[model samples]
Target: MIRQATPADLQTLAQLHSQCFAESWSAQEFARLLAIPGTFALLADTDAGFVLVRVAADEAEILSVGVRPERRQQGLGRALMAAAAERAFGHGAQTLFLEVSANNAPARTLYGALGFAEAGRRKAYYNEGGRKADALTLKARLPLGKSA
Candidate 1:
């Protein structure tokens, strides 16, 4: 089931992100965002595990999302994306945008399958320990009927 996230979920989200991303946001950052106007967060919970996400405005950029590493490729990511899209459209978003690591093939494929198109790229957007990673900017334009 998908539902709005509370501040209590931040710690688990932070830990999940640490396992998924080379660099992760602090719990404090997530807490701060949770209190911001126009920011939206959602989580999917099941017997297996959960996935969490935060988007900004109705036209949101996916701030972060992750499922338990042990549960990867079991479709939780897709579930989270679908939930975010629904929330975004319900809130009057015309388009959803996100920046995925250029090298993350699985995420790119998942986004592409869900109607997201590569709109642009940000070169060397993340630098960690002398290594750099570029970002692929993707967008999914929603039909007018889907918007509030």
Candidate 2:
């Protein structure tokens, strides 16, 4: 299950993000982003995960998506993404976009399962443990459906 996240979820979201990523977004950053128009956040039940997205014109982009380390591989990430797509579609978005670290095979598989295809790449976009990693930009038409 998923629910719309509010201001009260900032700390939880930041915590989960920190646990899931090498570099984390502070609660302050999440607060600032949430204040922007067309931005939205969704929290998975029990704070297992969350996805942040922004819609503009005919497109929506996943600003961030994270699942607690222990909760990964349980379909929580997929659920959060599916919910984000549904919300974005309702708001007039025709396509969804997100960027994933090229080295992250698990995430690449997840996005591919959701019908996302690589659209572009940013060289050395992420610095993890002092190593640079490329960021692959992916795109998918909404609303997201089950993978074959």
Largest lDDT belongs to which candidate? 2
Candidate 2, 1-148: lDDT as tens digits: 8999999999998998899887789999999999989999999979999999999988999999989988888999999999999999999998899999999999899998889999999999999889999999999988776332
30-142, model 1: which lDDT tens digit per residue? 77876777676676664223343344555767777777778888888888888777777777777888888887788888887888888899899877568898988988876
Estimate candidate 2's alpha-carbon lDDT, on a 0 to 1 scale: 0.92
TM-score of each: 0.83, 0.94
Cα displacement (Å) at residue 87, model 1: 0.6
User: Per the 3 Å backbone cut-off, how many clashing residue pairs does candidate 1 have?
Assistant: 0
Q: How many backbone clashes does candidate 2 have?
A: 0
Cα-based lDDT at residue 18, candidate 1: 79
Estimate every model's Cα lDDT from 0 to 1.
0.72, 0.92
Task: State candidate 2's TM-score.
Answer: 0.94
